[model samples]
Target chain A: MHFTSEPRLADGVLEREFTLGEIPGILWTPESASASAPVPLVLLGHPPLGLHKMYPRLVARAQRAAADGFAAATIELPGSGERPRSATADQARADLRRAREAGEPVDEEIVDRLVLPLVDKSVPEWQDALDALLSLPEIEGPVGYSGGVISIGIRLAVVEPRISAAVLFAGTVVPRALFEEARQVTIPLHVLLQWDDEANDRQAALALFDAFGSKEKTLHANMGGHTGVPQFAGDAAARFLARHLK
Target chain B: MHFTSEPRLADGVLEREFTLGEIPGILWTPESASASAPVPLVLLGHPPLGLHKMYPRLVARAQRAAADGFAAATIELPGSGERPRSATADQARADLRRAREAGEPVDEEIVDRLVLPLVDKSVPEWQDALDALLSLPEIEGPVGYSGGVISIGIRLAVVEPRISAAVLFAGTVVPRALFEEARQVTIPLHVLLQWDDEANDRQAALALFDAFGSKEKTLHANMGGHTGVPQFAGDAAARFLARHLK
Candidate 1:
């Protein structure tokens, strides 16, 4: 990993941007953390709109995690942020446009094309990020994952034993294979669903939640649109993460 | 609707080929069917491989319906049978090949492009065919739908009140929107699922089944690949159609 900027101190938190191989990411650690007494880590799943678009939420969530004595981080998902556009991404954009214009549901295939590569590329990058973050004296195990780009969260929760718990956002589409894989997830999960999300398939979201084999899974459904998550819901999710990580 | 050939008589059954506007179709009527004593009608959802490829299944299904004293019919789905190939179909084929080669799920966009137009075109066409068939004194209401291309089945179940019952094959993918629309369906439904279908998304199929609003729906899951549905399952589905249509 290559640090792109000097660490900045603010509000008792240390913040820095870095590139882990080809993946861009941001890391936030509470200033009070030390090698002898490490804090649990939380990896945030960046929404498809990229980190810049979601900066405020990312910062807020990370800050909340820091406030709760945990380190938080987020990586740029493939096809988002500063990554160069590829043919597949272009096709996915066109497909989205056509589906929207037609008032049709986005094709599952289009969704698979858009998300699977990100899951394939991002999961390993996240594992690497976890490795680097955990190597720091101030960041410890008993990790938690939070946010959208849900396929990544599902993959990480399944494959990365370090992610002890997950708070999954349901605004994104879940591929069928992911649903199959979800049955293998045995960790605690806190899934947030905006019940009236205009851009989401509510049934698919419910189905994915049902597919999780985790014995400790909770569905926090709120009445709103895709971004209409209430503040309390976030707090509740953070509390769940805190309970598991701590 | 224009009949392209004379109705042929065989084993107490009558068969003929016809065209509805630009679409080609086939109709079968039991000899016992007459103006004074009309028989219930069944519209078959021809599979994607075209009527020629599905001819045996269609004939057998129609024959079973006929023996059960119902008129049965099927039209070539758009992009299937002898329909001229288009750029969209070619792109979808290429996309499917790429997805399969990569051991990835085919993007929902490719599926939408490949199947949605067919769904759009076929539903109204099937409605029209229903109109023409019902107009014949030998065919009557309390209709049944059998087989698939599942999107068409979901649409027909939702839009056409003439269809009182359906036997839906779960071998195809269900688009997210269809799951929402499925909630409006109230007809008695018998869904056939090949539990281990190699190409089918089992979770999606289950989700779709769960989304059906029909209070009288039954899921008949068999163990096998897409075509592994056994003879007994078909007979059971026919029995279901018989129970509702007769």
Candidate 2:
């Protein structure tokens, strides 16, 4: 892990841009963070939209976490942001987009081809990011994963024992292959679903929630399109994280 | 309305039993309640199982509302509690019970017979009780309806303009007839569903939530049976009331 840019402070939070080998990432910690009293960390996950595209929302969430006395971080996905893109993945994405634009049912094969490889590649990056983040003197354990590519989040919940809880956004395309892995996730989960998201399936989301192995999982479905998650819903998700991490 | 018992203080809340004609009821108000800054009210909704049987839970919810500086109240449903029972309703209830106990699907007519009359007879009584409760010096408007027989809450949310918001418990049997009424409910709603409830149909609950016309509705589904709603879910519902009522 290497710091690629100077750390900056905003609203009492220390934000730093860094890189793990070739992957870019950022971390935000409260001003009170210290070696003696390290804070719990939350990994902010977003759609394959680059970190720059998601900065406004991610930083807002980071600020909220900092306000709640925790640290947050995120890493660029393999084929998103400035990272090198895979031709196969790019082809699958174009095909999926064309199908959706033409009002065609996205083939299960297309979904698997586009999503499975991303999940295969990103879960490790997140785990590696977690490894480096936790090793920081001011960032500690009992970590949580929040937001999407929900397939990655599901895989992390199942394989990454370091993540004790997660707040999953059921707003992304999930491969049928991930359903079994979803059932293997035993960590406490707080899943958010946009009730009328055009790109998402409500029944599939509900079925995934049922498949989770955890005894403490909640589904919060709000009315609106994909981006219209209400402010109170965000607050409630924060409270859920605070309940588990604090 | 006539006060049937002396007012008692518990946890800084004033609790009193009252009667509207033949209907028995209870009211709870915060210590901060006054005519000048009249507290908002929340009408506690529940199954038609009699107040004596539900007092512990009702008073607990009332105290929670009072702690948030809101007055709460409840009235006996017609054909329930110590009130005169209707032979027709009793027969419907028996038939419904036999169907459930025999592991058979409850007929639509049986559901209609059991739920419709109670909804018709009780909605007016609720309005009358609301008329009396809001007339009190310490109670004010921006009221909320919570818990269930969800059909009553649906009707109240539709017909009672005073209720600006509601937190409906989707843990009871909802008749199909209320689907249209559900669509008519335009108030801000926060609905709770016990996803694993044996008596409640999860898909039907989800459909009802979808049919609601409120733009600000949210569905909070937790893993549990009907009576096993977690403490955090209750706290979240209370927070919802505070946001709308206060």
Candidate 3:
């Protein structure tokens, strides 16, 4: 199933949708053409707290990237993101399954239109977005990615070849039962794990990091608890992107 | 007048007090080694809400540092690190007058410490602590320091000759009308500023950093709104200390 929507402007940011595989995602772009050149694209995958608008820093990072010659875009997954368009629980479950399999999730939330689904098995949804992203115009190339709380999103970004760099803030991992594909990915990965992340979530992140046998992986253990996309994270992400993408 | 307190332990973390000229401070240290080897000391200075218990990650940082052959501490400015020891309004005001030269308005709510008689302002409290620290049989020659929220503490660390390195997390400045001593410091300073810091605090930090004027200054604009210490500041602080001290 494919879903699409007309691009809308909230405040000044642009919100649009495109198809990735069989799923669709809301694309958040900076309202202004502030980039000095064809900037590196930052694909932001947010968490599923319904407070997608709380990503002021993400928006700010995008603006900073624009200021620093980088383009930024945020994608909403199925069952969350732009508008809640889920037909039923079965549809939600099916969307989740597809996301896990295809690496692209569906989006069906109506709030903020810029947030991500919070689940841990939406790899397919992410892939769908990645596929769609490659098809977008004026997006530049060689993407840098970041996410808050969404472990699956981090995993997707890390494993996906198109993602050259990634900063996972308070990341977690999918249970082995969910995705048995836990191996080392070659992409540069920076995991900013909050010391006081959710007990289970912390375990998940540790396990995932342990499973990731990449030599380039760096873990920054933060003192503050689970702060999603913390402002400090923006600078850190920028540094990571600079190191990996540039 | 110099204020001092014997080193004590709270929750197994080392705690002490000292006078910086006329200002008093309550310092908290992690329960690590006091061996002859120089250890990294992270001085945590809380927000204007006055000093509360040290944040958990800070304690953890201390623990990690201790494990990594470093010592960590948190200093409560007499005006605020500990909640219960703040001076009364009249005594505080009197101390401010006696130590602050002449007419100066102190924010009692933000900086109220247990009132005390005025002490001489010429004596450097941080230098005094260094003297005492060097005097300790267990302390070695190399020393490192970092602070947060309390701009004065960071200044104290920066200007002192013994402090080999410093990281000031979410620091603020003293109004020139109150105390303008931060500008004299030249140290390897790393300033961590919260993105959403409170009114004038961000500006204060920028001003302080500009004053410190270290060639190695690194400014990290974090995502948290006025929270002291970003999620990953400890790791960065540790790296900073390691670089400068060892």
Top lDDT hit:
2
Q: State in Å the error of residue A52, model 3.
A: 5.3
DockQ of each candidate relative to the true complex: 0.01, 0.97, 0.03
lDDT of 3 by residue, A86-131 (tens): 4553354555556557754333331112222334336666666666
lDDT at position A124, candidate 2:
91
lDDT of 1 at B228: 76
lDDT of 2: 0.92
How do the candidates rank by DockQ, highest first? 2, 3, 1
Q: Can you write out model 2's per-residue Cα lDDT over A1-246, one digit (the tens) per residue?
A: 999889999999999999999999999999999999999999999998899999999999999999989999999999989999888899999999999999998899999999999989999999999999999999998899998688999999999999999999998778887898888899999999999998788888889889888999999999888898899999999999999999
Report the error of model 3 at residue B40, Å: 17
Where is the poorest 10-residue window by lDDT in model 2 chain B? B168-177
Q: List the residue pairs that clash in candidate 1.
A: A107-B108, A108-B108, A109-B107, A109-B108, A110-B107, A110-B108, A110-B109
**Clash tally, candidates in order:** 7, 0, 43
Give the per-residue lDDT of model 3 (tens digit) for B173-198: 35442234555555666666664555
C-alpha-based local distance difference test score of model 1: 0.84
TM per prediction = 0.51, 0.99, 0.43
lDDT of 3 at B190: 60
> What is every candidate's alpha-carbon RMSD to the true fold?
19.0, 1.0, 18.2
What candidate 3 gets wrong by more than 4 Å, as runs, is A1-37, A50-58, A81-121, A171-173, A177-182, A199-204, A228-230, B1-246
